[model samples]
Every structure is written in C-alpha cells, then in structure tokens.
Target: MTQSTPSAQRRSNLKHRAILDAAAQAVAQQGYAAVTIEGVAALAGVGKQTIYRWWSSKAALLVEVYSDLVSRQALTPRSNGSLEQRLTGLLSALFRLYRSSSAGAILTGLIGEASRDEQVRAVLAEGLVVGRADIVTALVQAADASLNAQAVNEVVIAVVWQRLVLQPDSLDEAFAQHLAALALAAGRLS
Candidate 1:
C-alpha cells in the first residue's frame, strides 16, 4: 500500500484549515444562510469538489467549523486557583469569546439551524455543549468533591444558554463571577 508523502499531507492539512477558516469568516460576515460551497471554494481558492470531498452538506461543513472553533476556544479548569476563581475565568473567557468576535455569530447561526435539523443538533450538542459541560463538571468536582457534577453542569449550561440564545446582552465579567458564585453555592447545597 502506498502512503501519502509528507509534503502531500502538509498540503492537505493546509487546504483543510483554509477551508475551515474561510467558512468561519464567511459565516461571521454574511451569516450561515449566505455561505455556500461555491462561495467557500472561491474564498479558499479551491474547487467545489474539495469541499464536497470533505463534507456532505453546508450544515455538515458548519458543524465541523463550530467544532474546530469550540476545540480551540473552550477553557478548562486550572489547578492553580480556587474553584471559584478558575470557574469565573472559564466563564469570562467564554463570554468574551462569544461576545467580541465571529465565534458568537457562528454559534448563533449553527444553533438556529440545529432547531430544524436533528443531525445538526446532535453534532452541536455533542461537540459544543457536552464538551464544555464535561470541562465544567471536572471543575465543579475539583472545587468540591461532594458537589453534584451533573447538577452543576446543568446550571452552568442553563446560564450559558440563556446568555447565548435568550439574552446575549447579559454576558459580561460580572455576570460570570456571579454565576460562578451561584454554582458554588448550589454545589454546597447539593
């Protein structure tokens, strides 16, 4: 069997990253509905087949886009600080990521699509929501071994969802700190 050469692999990786980055930019600027395979291909300077070879549909492409963004941006628990401090940091980072950039627009677009598409919802929930929840759960447990990780995760996600979907204007550093305090208090009660 023949293997892909190192140069070939590098080129492939570059192309893949280019497409994802272009898609993100497109979504950020024009929104999901405005993005297309041909548009992304043109933006990435590739053939339409290149995108189709990797993704079956625009929604699938968007799932990958959000997945990549989430993997890069999601914060984890830090052992160097108290749980409240670390949690607050995580929340603040999330708020900033979602507030100040195209990441929020990408997420909002994907979320709106997820409402009508089961596959999109699954991918978004697994790759974005559950992944972040897992990180928060660990932080909650680290903060207090006796805390209910599941409940804490639920509360954390609820607050984030409220800010992301229901009330985007509510996200801020102060809110993050307050949310962390509430989570900590809830953990103690549980």
Candidate 2:
C-alpha cells in the first residue's frame, strides 16, 4: 500500500485533533449520555463515517477524549516538596480536575459503559487503570524505596475511584490530604 504524503498526513492529523476536540466539547456541553457520533461529527465538520473509521464506539471515542484531556492537563507528580506534601499536591490536583472540569463526568460515563461492553472494559483498563497505577507507583517508589509502592498505589487509586464514583462532590483538598496520609501510612506499614 502507498503511504500518504506529508501534507495529506498533516490534514489527517488536523482532522483527528478536531474530532477529539469536538468529542470533548460535546461531552462537556451535552454530557456523555447525550453525545453521539453524529453530533461529534457535526461539531467537528466531518462525516459520521469518519468518526467510525477512527473509533469503534461512543465509549471508545470518549476514552480518547478523556485521555487527551488528562494529557493536556499535564498532571505529573511534582518534585518540589516532601513525599507527603508532593503526594498531597498531586492528589489535590487530581481532585480539582475531577471537581472542576468535564473529565470527571466523562470518566464516570466510561466506567458505566465499561460494565456492559467488553471492548470498552478492556480499553478502559489498559488506557486508564494501568497508567494511573503506574504513575502512583512511580511516585511512591521515587520518594521512598522502602515503601510498599504497589499497595500505596492501589489504595490511592481505589480512594480516587471510590470518590469519583460515589461521592464526587467530596473530592476536596481535605480528602486529598486524607488520601495522601493514608497512602503514606499504608506504605509505612509495609
């Protein structure tokens, strides 16, 4: 098969970015349940078939959108403080993202969709769960090699997931501090 030229590739990349942006905007404005391929396509100025060609389902599209949102936010761990302070800062940043933006709603919808769709479940697990755990694990291990990084990562992610799913409104600074302390405590025990 022949490869596309540079200009053609640029056009494709632009369209892809547009589609992701449109999907995110649609979800932010209409919510995940109200979004559709047709709506995203219309918002992106592309045909519905274009969206289908890139993504298999609404869940898949939303996952990409969510991923894009997270990456764009650049939520990596900071290195300017003590371990507990850094962890608390990172957790607080995550909580603020969830409470202040459409990311939270998009993630909640993806979780619900994952329950019923195997493909969605697999994608979510690979795209989100593993990546999040790895980030937390790396942060914990970097700060204190003696800490049980895996357990700490699991607890941090579990608390975040629980709050995101059950008590999103409670994702505040206080909760972030609590979670960070809990992670440190768990790490100390190990």
Sliding window of 10 residues with minimal summed lDDT for model 1: 70-79
Query: What lDDT tens digits, residue by residue, belong to model 1 across residues 72-156?
Result: 8856556778888998998888788776666777777778888898887887787677755678887777667888877777788
Query: Could you tell me the C-alpha RMSD of candidate 1 in Å?
Result: 2.2
lDDT score of residue 68 within candidate 1: 80
Candidate number of the best TM-score: 2
lDDT of each: 0.81, 0.86
**TM-score, cand. 1 vs. native:** 0.87
Query: How many clashes would you count in candidate 1?
Result: 0
After superposition, candidate 2 runs with Cα above 4 Å error: none
